[model samples]
Target: MKITIAEYLLKRLKEVNVEHMFGVPGDYNLGFLDYV
Candidate 1:
């Protein structure tokens, strides 16, 4: 199985029990946001 960097980050957030997140979506982050 292949996991993207964004997916890995989301997994780590889940491990720490991060239920909510705040951010400003920009062109650079649009791809990363797809994992959310």
Candidate 2:
């Protein structure tokens, strides 16, 4: 299974009890934002 860098970071953030994440989405990050 392959995952994006955003997914790996989101997973890590989730582990730390993070329910919300904020960022300035760019063209490259838009794909990752879809999952969030």
Candidate 3:
């Protein structure tokens, strides 16, 4: 099985009880920002 970097980061954030991820929605990170 393989997990993507986005998946890993989301999991870690959840583990730390992170509730919000704030950032600008731009072309470069718009995709990744969706996971936030």
List residue ranges in candidate 1 displaced over 4 A.
none
**Prediction 3 TM-score vs. true:** 0.76
Error of 3 at 19 (Å): 0.6
Residues 1-36 of candidate 1: C-alpha lDDT, one tens digit per residue: 998999999999999999999999999999998889
> What lDDT does each candidate get?
0.95, 0.86, 0.84
Runs of candidate 3 with Cα error greater than 4 angstroms are: none
**How well is each residue in 1-34 modelled by candidate 3, as lDDT tens digits?**
9987888999999999999878877889877876
**Candidate 2 residues 1-36, lDDT tens each?**
998787898889889999877789899888888878
For all predicted structures, in order, the TM-scores are: 0.85, 0.59, 0.76
CA lDDT for candidate 3: 0.84
lDDT of 2: 0.86
TM-score pick, better of 2 and 3: 3
